[model samples]
Target chain A: MEEGDRLHLGSATLRSRLIHGTGKFPSAELLAQAIAASEAEMITLAVRRLHLDGDRRSELEGLDLSRYHLLPNTAGARSAEEAIRLAHLARAAGLSDFIKVEVVGHEATLLPDPLATFEATSRLVAEGYTVLPYTSDDVALALRLAEAGAAAVMPGAAPIGSTLGVLNPHNIRLIIQECPVPVIVDAGLGSPSDALRVMEWGAAGVLVNTGIARAKDPVGMARAFAAAVEVGRLAHRAGLAGESGEARHGYGASSPTAGLPVG
Target chain B: MTVGDLEVEAALGPEQLRTRLRASRLYVVTDDLTPLEKLPDLVQAAVAGGADLVQLRRKREPWAELVELARSLQEICRRGGGIFLVNDHVDLALAAQADGVHLGQGDVAVQEARERLGDRPLIGLSTHTPDQALKAQLLPLDYIAAGPVRATPTKPDSVEVGFQQVTAAALVSRVPVVAIGGLDEGASAIEAGADLVAVVRAVCAAPDPRLAASKLRQEAAAATPWRWIRLNGEPRKSPPGETVLELLARLGVEPAGVAVEVDGRIVPRERLAAELVSEGSALEVVHFVGGG
Candidate 1:
């Protein structure tokens, strides 16, 4: 990455373009190792109601949570109200005011409800929370979310944990082009290549949860994703060559034809 | 609930509550005139219609009944993002886990309420005269309610302190002035320098309480005394008594990874709570934004 090429998200300047999620990992030790390997400055964590039994030490225990900027997500929320309530609960729990609004509309697909996400974003934004709404690859909705004061617009490449990878690149590209805020490609990414593809398409960053955590070698996959993110960001900033529909041979010969005797 | 519990639950600290009060335009005061069974729906409708503050004022109701009603109303206000206060009852406010208690002249002293409620809940005092309004400024109050802008049956014995008193109170008092009583439409009161307009019959007795509250809110908002300031290089009118922190909160912009400059001077993060945004003040707020 170029000097000063930091990911800025609502008062948080992050150096890493890869944001890792601490879910689906087999063990807390591995989760911590994967997090370290990923080098993600911001890690997303789901905020749920604490058990009444006072068992506060969940999988998040034994991990140095303070190391990364905690991005608490309303993952289990099925409506705008639930998402708003969860966001408040997260803030009340002393987590950062940065919230990743994910109002799951579909139980089977686990897809975010665009309207609910927008509602939560607008409400949370009005309440001084740095809102990042996880929405579908809907260009118009992404633009709307950005207009509603989302710190960043996270458009899902596909369903959460589906690993389909960039289902509608055209829509994602449109969102990135039209959105006033940074477009972060979140969810449904299978491999490091998917992360690279989105970053190369000028996405601000990529969030990998199941893609990395569920991998056979979670730590290795995290490292691979991290490297891909960095290189892709660098490539985007450096600019890529334009493509042509058809190859035009000898338009401007690379081998000097004028000086060659065979010419 | 204790103040600490309320803070954790509502996530609204005293400063945030004060900010909410300052920004409030329509305040709906519930009366015993409405049927007890329909009170929740009425309060909900009023809140949905943009009532920024809802005060439960049941003069004749028993303590037990009042507590139950207060708790329900508090939930409505909490969900609607409105401040819930109990009239003349600090204990009830505490019992209901209300945002605060609005004290009348005959009620508990402002200092006493503050001591009992602590610093978390807001304490608003109602003043009848200009002198009272001026004197109330020295007391520990979050907001000052002025007037019976016109006479009403709700408080038949109290003097009808007109719009002039609102102006007087607004001018003399440091905190936000709430113009109350006989106010159906609050444009005039807001124009008279009242930050918020509190109504009882205007909303509670309306056929459509939501519409009434909405209209009242609109009128007050239209005539609100705004302090013109340049925020992030754009000309904007902010509510009075808006500190830098309050401004940030109102805009939903957190202080983290952000820089605020007022009138060309960089305001440190710690001073944001103290730095007041005065009229014509040029404020430049820059926040980072790029996250996955």
Candidate 2:
């Protein structure tokens, strides 16, 4: 198994392509266990302002954060200004400059504001922040972000925490094919199969948060997703047979036709 | 030698001068209302009290006397680390070796000023509307002054453009927008995106010019006059004089794994702190992040 491939993001190179988000987890213990089980070298945590006098401990306090690269996200920001401010606050708190630019436009759906995301990405990039913008499955916007100097363009397969899996494989495929920077499938994914499907479609990687965090057996699901990503990447690299609309090619048997007794 | 080359020879490049202009919060324009003999004291006091730039606007003074005063004021500005500019007199600015000249709508064309002054000295034009500010972008201008933000006796014939024009002009201006006219405390103008707030009576008419300038500077600093730059491809505001490294730090961005580009060229990481982010600069800061 040729597993020597590395994920080059901005300046850091990682062996594992599975990126796990620390959101919607049932408990700190479970979240920690799931993270360990997933084997993801990079994990995202949302940057939120701590209360003035609140006794709340950070979600990252107990975890051995040295094992993973901390990618702070501007998850709740609704505008470019807010997202840029949040990225700064995240860095001010001693987190790395690696920022996930997520500007939510629609509240109920938590759909990313593509315009704001792009705006934040550009501003953050201008301020020397590594920006990964979470946008919709719009290929053009993805390319635009890449051109704007996004480290990687994360086009959501579906809405955040929706668990609907890849809704537009065609668009995702186009994004992966056209984008100069790495195209990561983020959001709208559920189950290990969904992760595998995108990885097989030539995505650099997949970001799974709710899919594993909300599962009944989160640790088990994390392990499954890790394996799926690896296998899918291998399949893509090995070169799967091309799909065809013609029945002869679509339903063709793998066995040699000429050597068969019936032939 | 070209005027720009002279400026460079003087160790103040156009970019450096523009950066200083953008960082300037208080600009004191001398008035004919103040006595000629008292002008030097007023300028020294204002500069001491935090005025970043002082303009000699003695419209009625004789050329020789104006030149003498301009030379003295230029000395005061240089010693105080403040910019000295002549109002409407390119020759006076040249004679005194002033930092720049501020032009009015009725003064010599900006093209003519640039030709005479060369690219070295800063050339600021006074604009009354957003249209004028937008048009100023086509000229070789270093900055544009907008407003009489309030009605004043200095320009009684001209209507007060208000803070609205200041905001509009700031939006349209590719150069730094200086909000002028009847300004006392400059918080409102700074909030409206004016890079520097120019005043006549606010400091000059005050019993204590230094205290008045200091108060206005404090007020302007509180509101923070943000310099506009295209980041990524979007218009964004940054604090004036913020270096590439400080910008990253202010945003809580780590220097590691980050690349900074200003205009179209990449700024090496080691030079981030030295490179000042000026107005109308296009910067692209990039770094890696955790993604799929």
Candidate 3:
């Protein structure tokens, strides 16, 4: 498919293969420019403080926006309740429909709390949010998340910020098999090859931040990611020949169709 | 040339912008006029009419001329209780210490401005299409100028993006949207759901800028027809385990007029009785603030 092809959620389909985040950029201006250059369709943001119109010192200060769909994430929230509350605030501030539900139990590892992750996903789904839960590569937990009405499941290949590549490939592969919704591998992807590896294992997409953010050049990194995702997905569609002990067929006009129709 | 705070503009952050947004309607200053000897008078008039934010827009002028003009206007706008913004001049904006800078599509990118300016001042971008608006969401823009409600005299080269595009832009934009372009009659912009109505001759060359601004404010106020009401009954604080109707009963308000929106979706009336609620779930029981 082309870059503008729709990515289907439960009922909603998004255009654009790339999803960019709003943190860690030196400035908002660069963030906007990078997004434009990357041709991204979706962008994620976090709310640090309540922003009422006319306030001059808020975190949202100086960013001029009269258009664009904002997807607010529960980035720092530890519990399901906090994540839910954050989602509400995001709605009040004008980002209502879409939310990324993230629950971190251990702040040190920043690994998702599987139990709390499922709880939050379940509640958010019941409340009618298109919940995309981020968690460890636990097949059972992945199944539970989907059962909870999650639109998609995001299983990390490695700890966030680790950039160790896919550590739990077998588990991730298992989760992919068990999931009904799209299985997106998020966090711990160190490079474009890692992202491609996860997609090779049947992950529908990947949500990358630190990998791109920490790169020497962020804009160039974003372009690389876009290409990597495209090539990986295309490779999957093209299908690679599997290795086997069976003898290989000789290359020649062995088939009668090649020499054809002498009659 | 416009006189506003470069440090305060630098210090002027997103929190400040949000507060200002909630507190007042954003004002799109006329870009056609130059160093108004009576800038304070012009801004004072706008304040009297409830315009809180002012954008100083001047196109295609020499860099030095733009700076000189921006410096003067910024000071007057600041004294007049408004935030001043320079149009499409990041370098000049930083030099003049203007509260913020607004960039056209062809101007510097948002990230470049952020790098140069840091988190100190507000940044604005001009968008004419939905694609541009979507891209704008990824940047840290405080708000968007949804333009040219009509064919504007200030920018004859730009195409007019009628009110329909304006409303659509407002609904999809991640940040607040201000309608610009030929909004001589402020009511039209407000009716089209513009958070701000930007004009040129209407306020710049008016015989009485204050009156012109006040008239625009009045029209905007009149046009903002959102229905608001205080529920006669108190809303129940959602408990860890409670259904929508149970919560309504606890609050003693009939669940008839009040509709429940959990998370972001509206819960069906039939499901309200059995739908168990949880902490952090947002349950808004909305009733009509006005109806015959």
Top DockQ model: 2
Residue A250's lDDT within candidate 2 is 40
Which candidate wins on TM-score? 2
- lDDT of candidate 3 over A1-263, digit per residue (tens): 55654667655566555566556665545555656655666666675432212232422333333344456677788898888866665554443556778888888998888877888788878888877788888899888888888888888888877878899888998997779988878888879898777666667877776777667777777777777777777676555433122324444343676556677
In candidate 2, which residue pairs clash? A88-B251, A91-B252, A122-B232, A125-B285, A126-B285, A130-B287, A205-B292
The lDDT of each candidate is: 0.82, 0.83, 0.67
For all predicted structures, in order, the TM-scores are: 0.47, 0.48, 0.46
DockQ of 3: 0.02
DockQ order of candidates, top first? 2, 3, 1
- Model 2 residue runs over 4 Å out of place are A52-54, A243-251, B1-292
Residue B157, model 2: lDDT of: 88
For model 1, how does the per-residue alpha-carbon lDDT over B104-143 read when each residue is reduced to its tens digit? 8888889998999998888889888988987886788888
Model 2's TM-score against the true structure: 0.48
Residue A255 lDDT in candidate 1 = 73
lDDT of 3 by residue, B1-292 (tens): 3335343333345677566764455475764564544555666677666677777666666877667767766765665567778778788888778888888888899989988987767888888986776578778777777776678768888888888766666545556677887777766666665667777778777887788888887777666521111122211223234576775675565554344567556566677898876634555554321000
Off by over 4 Å in 3: A1-263, B1-14, B31-40, B60-65, B225-292
Chain A TM-score for predicted structure 2: 0.93
Evaluate residue A5 in candidate 1 and report its C-alpha lDDT on the 0 to 100 scale.
Answer: 92
